[model samples]
Target: DQQVKQNSPSLSVQEGRISILNCDYTNSMFDYFLWYKKYPAEGPTFLISISSIKDKNEDGRFTVFLNKSAKHLSLHIVPSQPGDSAVYFCAASAFAGNTPLVFGKGTRLSVIA
Candidate 1:
């Protein structure tokens, strides 16, 4: 079974609006949660991340929220721009160093001008 899951296959939003992406995990051992954004013909780039110890983490226009008890997480982007259009993947890993990240299927977000 997949340890990470993104229920929404895609999302669409108009420019300057807010976009929210949801994710769920089955692994309780995961302490580090991350969100990656991928564009066509390119690799996924790290966006924002949250540690299990913290409920939320933010970087500029990106924010990540983690709910350890529910094994769920979500990513929020405010004032969404056209450049924000990409496939967002939810990932998780244990606290151990060098551990490989487990990724969700990903949700495609489209921003309309």
Candidate 2:
């Protein structure tokens, strides 16, 4: 089953604090992992990604860590801001190009003042 799971529906954090979101996958075939941040009625933009070949990937304020053995991954946002308040989606692709990407329901994050 091509299910990428984000069990938490929402998270609230104070400004300048770290925010962490968790995800899990049931499909062993998934080799690429991505985290997308979305606003209302907007499509998701690519945040950061980690390939199955690597255990960790980082970009600016965002970081993604993947554990293939546990089929689990997490996204960490440092110094979270009010602007970071939005929905975050966890996605997986077995292969690049043309293949459809599977996405989880999403996690709504709210950064407080």
Candidate 3:
């Protein structure tokens, strides 16, 4: 069974609109959650992250919300731009210096201009 899951295969939004992506996890030990955006032929770039201790974290146009009790997390992008189009992956890991992240299947987001 997959520890992390992204049920939506894809999402589309018009430019300047908001885009929301959801993720769920089965592992309760996971304390660190991260979101990464990947483009074709490139490595995933780190977007935003949240610790289990915090309910929400935001940076500029990106925000990550974590609900520990529900084992769920969501990523929000405000004023979505065309450049924001990419595959988003949600990853989780137990708090450790070098623990590997367990990743969910990516959700493709297309931002139309």
Candidate 4:
């Protein structure tokens, strides 16, 4: 069984719009979350992250919010640009920075210009 899941396989938003990507996890132990964005053949690049201690974290145009009670998390990108088009993966681990992470299949986001 998959520990993490991105229910939407794909999403599209016009340039300058807000893009929201959702993820759900089955493991309640998961307390740390990371979001990665990947383009085509390139490796997934770290985007933003949030710890269970906090409900929300933001960096520039990116923000990730964690809902521990619901076992869900979301990544939001504002003023989405064409360059932001990529596959976004949601990863989680019970421990922070020491153990492996369970990753979702990913959601392909297309920002149309």
Residue range with the least summed lDDT across 10 consecutive positions in model 3: 91-100
lDDT of each: 0.94, 0.92, 0.95, 0.94
Sort every candidate by lDDT, greatest first.
Answer: 3, 4, 1, 2
Model 3 alpha-carbon miss at residue 37, Å = 0.4
Model 4 bad stretches (over 4 Å): none
Off by over 4 Å in 1: 96-98
Quote model 1's TM-score: 0.96
Q: Which 10 consecutive positions of candidate 1 have the poorest summed lDDT? A: 91-100
By lDDT, the best candidate is: 3
Measured over all alpha carbons after superposition, the RMSD of each candidate to the real structure, in angstroms, is 1.0, 1.4, 1.0, 0.7
| Local lDDT at 54 for model 2 | 91
- Give lDDT: candidate 2, residue 22: 96
Q: Pick the candidate with the highest TM-score.
A: 4
lDDT of 4 by residue, 1-113 (tens): 99999999999999999999999999888888999999998999999989899999999999998889899999999989999999999999886645698899999999999
Which 10 successive residues of model 2 have the least lDDT summed?
A: 93-102
> What are the clashing pairs of model 3?
none
lDDT of 3 by residue, 2-110 (tens): 9999999999999999999999999888999999999999999999988888999999999999988899999999989999999999999996414799999999999
| Per-model TM-score versus the true fold | 0.96, 0.94, 0.97, 0.97
The residue pairs in collision within model 4 are: none
